[model samples]
Target: MKKENIKKVVLAYSGGLDTSIIIPWLKENYNNCEVVAVSGDVGQGTELDGLEEKAKATGASKLYVLDLKKDFVENYIFPTLKFGAKYEDYLLGTSFARPCIAKALADIAIKEGADAICHGCTGKGNDQVRFELTLKALCPDMAIIAPWREWDIKSRDEEIDYAEAHHIPLKINRETNYSKDKNLWHLSHEGLDLESPANEPQYNHPGFLELGVSPEQAPDTPTYVTIHFEKGVPTAVDGKEMGAVELVEYLNKLGGENGIGLLDIVENRLVGMKSRGVYETPGGAILYKAINVLETITLDKESAHLKEQLAQKYADIVYNGQWFTPLREALDAFANSLAKTVTGDVKLKLYKGNMINAGVTSPFTLYDEQTASFGEDEDYNQADAAGFINLFGLSIKERAKLSKSWPKIED
Candidate 1:
């Protein structure tokens, strides 16, 4: 646990502003410990470009760029989708991603036999809890170092200054500074003008909107997309079968073009602070919408309703960094059982940020057209309604008779 004892440290590196400076800070504070940077490639695309060189240039002894795209989608994203977990209005993008990445970091640490695992999560953010809890769960004996809590760097400006002093190349400056976290599921923007709830997001600002145009700026024509699901996992887009990562990527283009998934919310962090964030989750929004429509047909009334109630609690568990707990696994088992019938196809119309369900179909649908029709059918007898109503209203009828027999009160 002591600084002198840490010979090598595995850091969760993103090649971002905070992490770029962290390499040097770790060396200075931890007696020049060998720093090994591990970057999780969760479909951030060009964000990971040149990351290895960048890490080495920043004084890291080595770098590992693990391709976690498929693992991230299949293991983390799909399970959460089955549970329909959303933390407030967040879609649990950044919330669930932390654990997935940390799990990878823990594995790499074990393989490298590193003395400590380091992260750039700040003291006041939910990511600190998420990353540390996962590390604690996966590798209980590993030493963990969080620089944001120990380092004296007070602000982003100080971090930038530290980067310059250490000759570490950075992609951010004070003026264009917006703290961003991007994964396959979503891209989250925070800080600067977003700190104030009243300031409208500057979507038009150069480099501000990476995914797509705003809803108002989208084309006038509507775009239609058909999604196929098998056992609650998205399998294809627009009649073309795709792998999990490819399907999400394909939908991201479509949804972004139509301005589909943009949200601004003020949410309660696990650290007990209210934080405002803007999220762009183009592909994920469409998938969630389509799957929910299919669930309506596939799931029975009680299972569907109970899943809705359980989703809130599941969201809390994920958001509060309890992903490895037994309760989460139990909930996943329930969700998976319900999802067995969730195979179907959903068609949707995307126009100006609106997702309108056009149609839904499933082989396991519970809807029976003949039984629900208004016309007389052999499945039901009209005379049965009278007896059924009488039995159903028996308590009400007894209460009424008792009320009449009671003496009237004086005015």
Candidate 2:
């Protein structure tokens, strides 16, 4: 907590407006401590371009750019997907990536033997809690410094002015000042006109949309995609086998072309405030839908329904930054057990933001079409339903008889 205690600080740098200023701020506030900048690559693509030069130019002693895309999808995104975790209508694209990025930062900090870890998350945002909670869980001895909470600058305008005065090069300006977070899972947009719920999101705004086109701008024809899943994990797209990262990237391109994922919502933040955000999650949407189709065939009545209820708890845990908790691990264990039978292929049609199920097939399906058919079948007898109806409705019949015997009262 004291400035003199921090001899070296590893900062989570994104080369964004806030993080670009954090390097110099850490140097000034920590009594000119050595700053090591770390940028986690969770599929941000060109957003990370020029980050090494930028970090060094902004007063960082050294920089480490970690490629965490494969780890992110396999460990975080896929597990959450198996549990069907969705925070309201959100697919939890941004919520799940924070802990992953923070974990990478913590690992680098330990490797670099840094005394403290720093981030640019503001006090009002949920990311501060997510990043710090992860650090606390992983490396309790490491100190955390959040400059947005300690710094004198209050607003984006003030931060920009400070950046200008300090000669910190920034890619964002006033006109394109929407706060954004991007990873392999999704791209979230906030601030600027998005702060007002009444204003429709500028989906077509320059630099606002990187993943997909708007539904209105999508092609007139529908795009069909076939996905194969093994143990609830997506394995291939259109019969082409790929790794976790490769499959998601492939779907992102296909789904983006069809405008399959776009969400606008005013969600409750972990910081006890409601915030509006627009999100684009082209590939993630396809995965969620496809996996659900496989689940319908594999999971039976009781286990499937119970998992659905537990999924809400799972979503809450991930959204509230409780990824490292025991409950989450236990839940994942249960989900993994249930996913053993969820191996199949699902076909879907994507058209102008709508994902319609074409067909789903699995080896473990409970459906028996022959017995379920209306025509005569060797497996089922019509007389069996009469006995079943009598037994199943016995309690209801008794209740009705008792009600008939009771005296009627005037209202």
Candidate 3:
């Protein structure tokens, strides 16, 4: 975009140090462009506090905070859960949130007649692709600016210095500034000492991990809870039906207490790089496991196998910033179809990081106790197996008759 002609820009701002520093950077570089800050509330909870005042103090001309938590969990997160998509064991907390947040940025940019849409996603991360792809899909003509790619502040230390120089107030100092993302689905931690593969996570380090404790610190006794689902979406825990947001929040509390979900991995990013990170997805972990267990009895072998293969494709799409693509929409339709039989209750016993099945029941189960039992039943006869097995192995039998292995057996 031509800096001289641009009058205004819209920024995807979070009330964090990273984005806070960008507000001033845009004005200084873009010929004093007026920045309209937009933040989407996807259950970051207290993280959104004082965002308005912070945005204004940090040089944003105006701020628009949209309440997107309900839509976030219900639409984006639930579909991933239904498809059982996991990218290298990550629950995709930050991946899905980018589209929701970037959509808001695009809409606000268009509505405000802003010249460009800007974001603080780093040059090395997957989020830049996620944000830019959504912006291109929604508002292709709008000029897009990513501060990390353009700015000369080469490191977090330099960025902190810039923030302090501009008199920007921040919640983090240099030592504790882990690149983090938090939302309704989960929380993620990256950077700092976590950059090295050899370094074990300092789990007990003061404030290192949040949302849950380390598994070793979990209770000795297992915590049992029954998860109820209706058409693949988790509806309740222990017979208490709840709204989508409320249900996830409740499970977060229970799951966190038992150290339910904590993931660490080095994952391939869409930008052609691998980055190591830790994710805390307590409630999401419980739900993903619960739905898989519930589907075990309900789904037929062929359908279950087909869906299992498709789930990986769906996970790749979400991770690769293709959330707004037509292919993803088509996959979602199939996921919904497979999830029709996924209504049930899954009783799970959580001990440390382990999720053991206590019980599972569903109305549409394909398994029949009478037909499968060893005892005599009208649905099946023992003698029928001989003829069926003979027919099933006819090709093998014919081949064996023509083979030399028969001579060895006869001898």
Candidate 4:
């Protein structure tokens, strides 16, 4: 709740080039504020292995590496998945993770008695908005320090050079050039060749497709997977119940083998510019298909139609980092209420990069075989249709007759 005198600052550290430079940058700018590096473990794997010691070596007063994989899957990913959210056909893999990570940073800031929270997100990226909005939502009093907007560095290369000049350790590897953000649900790749929409993504190596294989390299045989839902949340896969984290992991493996859930889109950033991004969201895509199938079987016609409309808006709200706003909360409530009847089991066949619906069943299904049957039946609804049609078309017929009586216009 203080002005500019920030005694301490907690940064959302990722042990990347940008964050490695940010520790020194924050210290240089903030009048000797203690830098507390906090790394969130959302399934970044070995990238986080040496992060704690690396943070200390990078001049962090303290390093806090919180393992949030469970929370990320259970609280953040699942809730968003309930609505089958996708931002322009790209599973909101990176969008939903930012708020939870930002929340973690803000929580640490509160606990550390830090006046400010720092993030390495650039001014031009969606993450800056995502991180700041979350900080505002959770800890409105906390000050924010965004180095990309303030620092003299012009590009990622310049930041890397700064890190090199400052003797910061480098953990460069084959997956180096392209900027990537990975988590349990999905992995997103941007920058470099991905920046150009015309450039066909070169999926040549192991880490090229972060989650799994490209469609071209996938196995020839199809893989079938069944997903069960209770009140719109994925409960099990192939009749086997598993925890949230494990469920996503399992789905990812199956979907990846089938070469499913790969997307390339040139999206309009929250900032002014447009950027092309390639996303691998195997698990998310499968879950979305399964849930949509379930909804079709269980939800009534009007609710299903309304949900389709709301789902897009919900994706936009989350994609635009408006998760904490009142409108988002109201929309979430509306989504949750609609999801109540969306309980069922969806059988899907995954073959050579395609997920085809096998079947779906639910107790609340509105599909009635007897009433819908064309053959002879005791329901006897065919004769009643003549009278119903007469009344239903009366207004239109009357209006047409009146139009004929009016003076004809010259064509």
The reply for model 4, stretches above 4 Å from the true place, is 1-4, 173-176, 405-411
Writing each residue's lDDT as its tens digit, candidate 2 over 192-256 gives 89999999987776657889998888999999999999998999988999999999998998888
Which window of ten consecutive residues has the lowest lDDT sum in model 4?
169-178
**Tens-digit lDDT track of model 4 for 1-411:** 343488799999999878988988777778777899999888888788888788888789989888898898877777788877777887788888898888889889888898899998988899999999999899998889888988799977777788888999877633377888888888888887777788898875666886778878888877778888888788889999988888999999899888889888888887878889888888888998888888877878888888788888889988988877898788778878988888888999987678899988988787778767887778776889899999999999999989988997899
Model 3 regions lying over 4 Å from their true place: 394-411
lDDT of each: 0.92, 0.92, 0.89, 0.84
lDDT of 1 by residue, 1-411 (tens): 889999999999999998999998999999999999999999888888898899998889999999999999999899998878888877998888889999999999999999999999999999999999999999999999999999888899999999888898888789878899999989999999999999999876667878877998788999999999999999988889999999988888899988889999999998899999999999999988999999988999999999999999999999988999999999999999999989989999999999999999999999888788999787988889999999999999999989987898789
Q: How many residue pairs clash in each candidate?
A: 0, 0, 0, 0
Q: lDDT of candidate 2 vs native?
A: 0.92
List TM-scores for all candidates, in order: 0.96, 0.96, 0.95, 0.94
Question: Candidate 2: misplaced stretches above 4 Å?
Answer: 403-411
Model 1, residue 238: C-alpha shift (Å): 1.9
TM-score of 2: 0.96
Give one digit per residue, the lDDT tens place, for model 3 in 73-110.
98899999999999888888998999988888888998
